[model samples]
Target: MTPVLDPDTSLWHVIALEVQRQRIAHDLSVTQLATRLRVDRSTVSRIEHGWRKLSPEQADGLDAMWDLQHLFRRLVRFAAATDDGNWFTGLMDFEKEASLHRMWEALLVPGLLQTPDYARAMISTKSADVEAGLETRLARQASVFDGERAPRVSVILNWAAIEQCVGGRDVMRGQLAHLLEMGERPNVNIRVMERDAGAHVGLDGSFRLLTISDREIAYSASPERGRLVLEASDVHDYAVRYDLISNLASPVGASRRLIEQALEA
Candidate 1:
């Protein structure tokens, strides 16, 4: 049965429903389809209900089962080409299958390690719709611990990010401590670009590089609008810019010291 459309149904949901239709049209039951896809029945149900995203492998399995090899390949290509929807939703989907994440933040603490207070302050300051914003941000943070394989993440923050004092000294202290804890993880690297480091490409804004298999997609945020995902030549240019910014940024050791100094101040 086709699921009723709800305001919350995303593009992923539409795609999932299409897959289900094809399966049923081919006389395949949910269990048979799940077995063919090598995923649990609940996984199939979640994907259909838009409660979960399909990995590239799972998408491929469904494509083959539904005799949609060409269309499935195209959908996967589109998924790889862009970072997808809302910022938080896109982050969850990207992190799920990414092998590496390259990030830069100019004005605020990166979301992954933000304390509740800091996150609250950020949302309150920026979001016109605070209630929805808070829920989305919190949900995004929760996804970091969901998957079995976490991506290797490298984040570069502007020194100004530490000095801003978003939620006051005590909150800043908690945030700095959180950063220190997160940096100690074997798969994560954090760096800070000093204020007087001279001009750099990242001065424009913050952006992310998400590596899915052999392809890398880029996303940037705008103050007036929302997020924009980059592809092809645009992704390549942002990558070059990111590399230049990283080069100008302080080394990890110095960055940690900078954070410590900010916390003390």
Candidate 2:
């Protein structure tokens, strides 16, 4: 038997294809599988296409249905861990299949739209073992626009991010300009939360919520805590926090003016 590919290394598209193949071999139509899984046919299709992630319970069901108990266990473990390498690999899987990405940045601009100069400055300040962080950052951004499945992203940045001037005047200016350009895209949305905004949960740090179909996963950074991956209940909490932050954030039109003002200043 050929060795089974590690789901972490395989693209999400490939994973979905394998799932579809197994379902077919078992003589299961989408509706039939959905009935067994207690979900809608479209939900089954989304899972098979990697447009939705399997929760732990769903993974267990899949394992029994496909005789993949071991593989499913490994996938659940991978999802629960904080390994940056593994986390990034999983992110690549989602990036390949996700239809939308919703993110909140309290510290700096999110990685996907960072300019090279801005990226270098941010990476230079980090103590991470990873060298060429800037290069990797750029590559991730390129991936977003590279293919047909390019994610529709909505990013909310804190007003303080613009005021902090991570890379000084020239670089900050360029970054703001880049944000302006990226915001013009049909699939991208940019907003800013003002300092005066009262009581928002995301004031602590940056977090991202990636959506595939209707399933969402949350990720956050920590020093002692490391990378935190939240699903199910935790995912819902973070989503609520995101909504609160967005409510207090500047509107899109106002956010544009604020960026313009920062550029002028």
How many Å off is the CA of 228 in candidate 2? 4.7
Worst 10 residues of 1 by lDDT: 80-89
lDDT of 2 by residue, 92-155 (tens): 5565557788889887887888888888888787647345687677677777777767678989
lDDT tens digits by residue: candidate 1, 115-232: 8888888888877887787777677666664567777889999988888888788988999988988888888899999989887788899888888887888878677544445347
Q: Give TM-scores for every candidate, taking all chains together and pairing residue i with residue i.
A: 0.69, 0.68
RMSD of each: 8.1, 10.3
Query: How does candidate 1 fare on TM-score?
Result: 0.69
Candidate 2 global CA lDDT score = 0.75
For model 2, the superposed segments whose C-alpha errors exceed 4 Å read 1-86, 127-131, 223-230
* TM-score, predicted candidate 2 vs. hidden true structure: 0.68
